[model samples]
Target: MEENIDIEQLRIPEALTGPEAADFLRVVEISRLVRMHTWGNDELAYTAGELLAQCHDPYEWNVMLIARVNGVIEGCAGIAMPLDDNTELAHVTLDVLPQAEGRGMGRKLLEAAEQFVRGENRKSVLVETNHAASALAAAANEAEQIHPTSGTGYLPLSSREARFAFSAGYELERVERFSSCAIPLDEALIAQNMEATHAPHRSKYRVHQWLDACPDRWAGDIARLEQCLDRGQSPGHGDWDIAKLREAEEFSALTGRRTIVTAAECVADDALIGFTSISILNHRQDVAFQDETFVELEHKGKGVGLRIKEANMTKVMREFPEVRTIYTWNAPGNSQLLEVNAQLGFISAGITAQWRKDFNAY
Candidate 1:
């Protein structure tokens, strides 16, 4: 009976129960191995702990589905809803056991995820894969044609799995570079010159850490940040929104991790003028991800961006001693941010390219 098992015989579990989580971990490990075998890249493989941390959070609007046959897990798939603003799109991320390859189980699991998205009235789906999983990528491409939406894949700046995304009908959209830099925390504090440098005209803002209870304030700031994302950069496959930001914040709080958010505001006007954030991941306990840094256009060109980044880095060094390295990604053309990071001592480490494809074109 096991030998004759068909895709229909495979059970697709809706929720990631405890046992299912363990099984999913095993499946992920196997999938990672297959990825390495195909592309000779170990970075494509994710540890079981990392997978759990990403999918088990309640604040994350992630739908995890597992394919099982006769009680043995064989595959896993998940879709993360956009966190800050664009909830209409569901990002597809999936994996399957090596033995299950060439079978139709991957397609079935993908169909299930698509159905879930349609039920939620989502407009599109997005995914990133590596070359080792060409079969899986092919399945996704076929599904994209049936669904008709924008799908994208990218060469991960630091992973081998990105090659698979290239074969799955995803085109190169943009190139992004990842780099790390160390800040000299022990340096003597420069005298705070209220008027000594290229400071903004109206200055009344202070840097603050986001707390669990400040949902309303955080949500408002996230909304403003979303606007900044839209204005500062062109819209990508997935966009940001307030709901997504709330979900991300809730997830971080539940996991006991800290997301350092610094904002520059007008003191007399009491308006949020600029913002930036660094998410500390537990997987790489010694590293912090400098994410989603943005300043309003009106607030740019002044020294607010540098001031906020410097203040935030100083606070991070003092508060999180375990974090020895900070990593961030910037679009290839973003010279402005590059200058700020360079001044802070960040150096180039690697590059990742964004790839996208419109299903309608295919």
Candidate 2:
């Protein structure tokens, strides 16, 4: 039986509760399809369960809109606020089912998302899309730039998606390369050596690994983590405080699929020094994904960074023996961390470019 998509019945909702699981599943399935279509690869496709887990995170304020025709979900859009920083940029991710395309549903969803951001008094909104969506490109180009609010589009690489951003009035701002280095976990002596080198400065600090929940003792460490993250390369955004960092921790605990391995100071210090965490994403039973690793500026130059990483990698190998390959990403300019990983036997896999444009002028 063919269900009719009633554009008029579609509505945007603030939150998804337990009762809406079925509808949310449909939305996620549609979203996965859209992502796969846009990226031309299934490797990036996230399942409905994964989306649900992600949405459960408390740190991100995720909004979902459902386009329904007679109560059947035909399309959906979502937005997330990272770090819960009021001054930081908010991101939007949207998708319409194949049957609902070309019917102006996507435009409606975008408008709803924009209104939500405006209501929050946010400074800007960002979205990532591939080159395949011509209509999305056109919509971005035609989007109005309200005073104090602008839209920018970026292309990571030259593709059908890059052209879309160009047509939408987005310009390339910077190209960030995402590279991964992997090392075999069989070298315990190397790990111990790395730990020993970083031990003098790391003496007062301790490393904690969390598998199922967020640790309470690391609250201060979380705050310091945010500070370090600020120093790292990201799309320009405002700073984060303790409250926001807590929210981020809660969110990761709820949403992240990897083991959260954190190293932090055992005693509080006024200098805001000592801490790092590496999220290991277990994609396949045997593959580990090193999504991010960070250390504070004051703690730099010491072996603290490398020691924490070595400890985390050692833990992952011990706990998840099935994991054969570990993947990681680094900004193009981070030579220090890059050199450390190189010493540990991580080889460059590939590069992903970061592109951006200021939408304020659009």
How does residue 320 of candidate 1 score in lDDT? Answer: 79
RMSD of each: 7.9, 7.7
Q: What is candidate 2's lDDT per residue for 58-125, written digit by digit as tens? A: 54666676677567677776877664444555676767776667666666766676677767666566
Q: Write the per-residue lDDT of candidate 1 for residues 1-362, one digit (tens) a residue.
A: 64432332222234456664555556667667765665455343555556666665443476667676666667767777755457677777667666667666666776676677777777666664433333334444342321112222333322333444454555555556567766444354323322332444534455555533335655676676666687657474134567666665677767666777777776765667777777676555566778777777776777777777777777777767788778787775678888888777787755444444444454
The CA root-mean-square deviation of candidate 1, after full C-alpha superposition on the true structure, stands at 7.9
In model 2, residue pairs whose N, Cα or C atoms come closer than 3 Å (at least 3 residues apart or on different chains), thus clashing, are 5-69, 6-69, 130-161, 131-160, 131-161, 151-359, 176-354, 286-322, 286-323
* TM-scores vs. true structure, each candidate: 0.62, 0.61
TM-score, candidate 2, is 0.61
- In terms of TM-score, the best-performing candidate is 1
